[model samples]
Target: MISAHLPALQVVIPLLAAPACVVVRQSTLTWLLALLVSWISFAIALTLLVQTFFNGPMSYELGGWAAPLGIEYAVDVVNAFVLVIVSGVSSVVLISAKESIERETHIKRTHLVYTGWLLCLTGLLGITITGDVFNVFVFLEIASLSSYLLVSLGPDRRALTAAFQYLVMGTIGATFILIGVGLLYMMTGTLNMADLAQRIPGVAQTTTVRAGFAFLVLGISLKAAVFPLHYWLPNAYTFAPSAVTAFMAGSATKVSIYLLLRFFFDIFSETFSLRTMRLDLILLILGVIAIFSMSLVAIYQSNVKRMLAYSSVAQVGYMVIGISLATTTGLTAGIVHLFNHALMKCALFLALGCIVFRLNSVDLKDLAGVGRRMPWTMAAFVIGGLSLIGVPATVGFISKWYLVLAALERDWWWLAFMVVASSLLAVIYIWRVVETAYFKTGPVANTEEAPLILLVPTWVLIVANIYFGVSAVDTISFATRAADQLLSTF
Candidate 1:
């Protein structure tokens, strides 16, 4: 019976624990509560993924109300995989969060910080699990509001500015999403995604439907921080507390990408979105621009966090390109990279958190000779960086390989070439950090490595980067199944 309710519990546990953190008002107690809730969410996510994989799609109606009349939580291979990524990344980030949060934020506000963390997690999980379009908007705001709080918790005054900027942009995006959902409801007379999916095709040619599609795409793209719309991301990541940066860098944008897939393939139907609306061309052009332009921008950044932030925008391009191809292999590539990028980026950011722990900064100049001092931390950074560059035997390489194969599958030799070229740019920026840490000389300071509390969780992600890279069969299988299921809707 409890197992039957796992879908509801996936989100409810964190949702309830957030206010509990506020009530506790003790840093240590709140942190333990957050960590416990995060791990429990991860376990539920894993169980749901297994259940979906073996038993096919699972749906739960709230209060036993069925169909379009009440809210539903739907679990399939696609979002089930994403739930694992979000909760798994959050669990690891929280494991390493205590020390970093204590140093980067006011001690007295730690309970609020964890409260925001849990609320943000709740929002993300809720967004992934819910089947109603309106519920998605509700959960999106919850996540956005909590994210602004987390970003503003940084010690720097500029953190406040970053949060404000994110707030302005996020509110605009959410408004667009709401308008889009309203238009769809006006035409379809339903708010449930499954119901809308069946009804949208009948009205596909209407101007109102087209306007809704445009608004939804624009809104989600902003949330995903797709290039040219990504102005808010770098500063937010740079100014946020290191643990917050690590958690969000891993989870937030990836979830936005999942929504894109859900809409393009699951709700809109690939035939309508990719073929009739020509979304593939639009995405392909934008995705290519994001890859080259953002990677070029990253090369000149002085702050390591900002550089990686720009790099993240570039990586989003890879996933976008995968979706743009609109084939089974292409969708599979996009979905798999969604999972891989989360692992590598989180590891890289967590490693940066370790550097910040010992050095109090992530500036390249400050990291001079850090390799000699913090060997393990820098080594983890190197591995994660190699993965980012798509070096062999790393998760990044696996993603790029699929992307290239997808491009070549369409006889798009030029597109495949661009993918490789963009990766070289990743090499340039990553090597900048590597050369600074290992090769440069600077004044000696604390040569001690980061404490075990931090190093252990950071390495956990690093190990996953390698383990999944070498043994990617299961991930690829799930991604393939997810892709097949999405494409089946056509």
Candidate 2:
């Protein structure tokens, strides 16, 4: 009977587990507890996804109170999909975090690490499920605050600087969201997203709605690290602990993008988002420019993590392009890419984690012949890299294939050409590592491969990447349905 409310359980389990992790006092216990909570969250999220799929949609009112009067937890296919992404990614990354955290974090601070991780998980889940716009900002801050701490957990002193930069940027972003929410509340006297959705249209012509939309878009864009606003990403990714890097890479920004979608499509009417505004054009142009510019920047980077960081910005461009198209097909492409890219980034960043474990640095030249010693790890890297390059039959190929279809739906053949061109640049950057690892002789010729623990989680995501690319029915169906829901908002 309690199982009926899996939507609320999905988030409540993680939110309540975080502080308990700190209270546990043992690192392994904390990690184990956190892992159990994460898996439980994933299971519940999956259940919610299925329930919503079969039953149309479900919303749980907190304490049995009705909407607009109490906290509402909504679990449509879209939020359910996001729930799965956040929980699933966090679960997989947690499997790889045990040893990485042990090696990188101070002995006395391990409990803090576990606690912060749990809080971040809670934040991500909360953002996805909350129906209140103000609660979204609250949970976003929870996640952002945890993230700043995680980024500072790196062994380098620069981690402190990176964390500070992230703190400033994240605070500003959160402030923008809060102010926007405040404006919405001031104008409409309600904070429930659905209520806002209905009320906002009446004020669509007012300066307040426009101001709220602008602030929300800009704030979420910065949080998502869209190009020109992504300055905090490279350093944060480079300086964070391996586990921290993997977790944030897989989940954080993607969640922010989900928020952006919920606002532009669901909260604000399509009439305001499309015809009354230049959002589609702006997103399209920014996405294309980011794709080309970041790809170019990646080729010149000496630091591998920073290189991949820039690559993430470019990959975000693909998703933004999908959103800008605003077509059903384009949205499907965008949401599917969000899921696929999370796995791809997890695999790639896990590979970098392995390199860091062995050599303690991600400098491209330093990686020379270690591939011979770390064949499995390097092989995983190559597979993920190939996926990044959009090699046919890989998961990336599936994403771009749909993206191309989306572009053609709008008769934007130049976008198709640009997609191919960007993939070519990906080939160059990814091949640089392939050439270094497989073909060149290096200084560290006898290093051992990564531990099985790390390799297991790394391969889990990599293999899933291939599996999904080949068998995309479930993903396609969910994304398609999600697209329909978003577009049906009109």
RMSD of each: 0.9, 1.0
lDDT of each: 0.93, 0.89
For residues 111-222, write the lDDT of model 1, one tens digit per residue.
8888999999999999898899999999999999999999998768999999999999989998999999999988999999999999999999999998999899889889
Model 1 vs. true fold: TM: 0.99
Per-candidate TM vs. native?
A: 0.99, 0.98
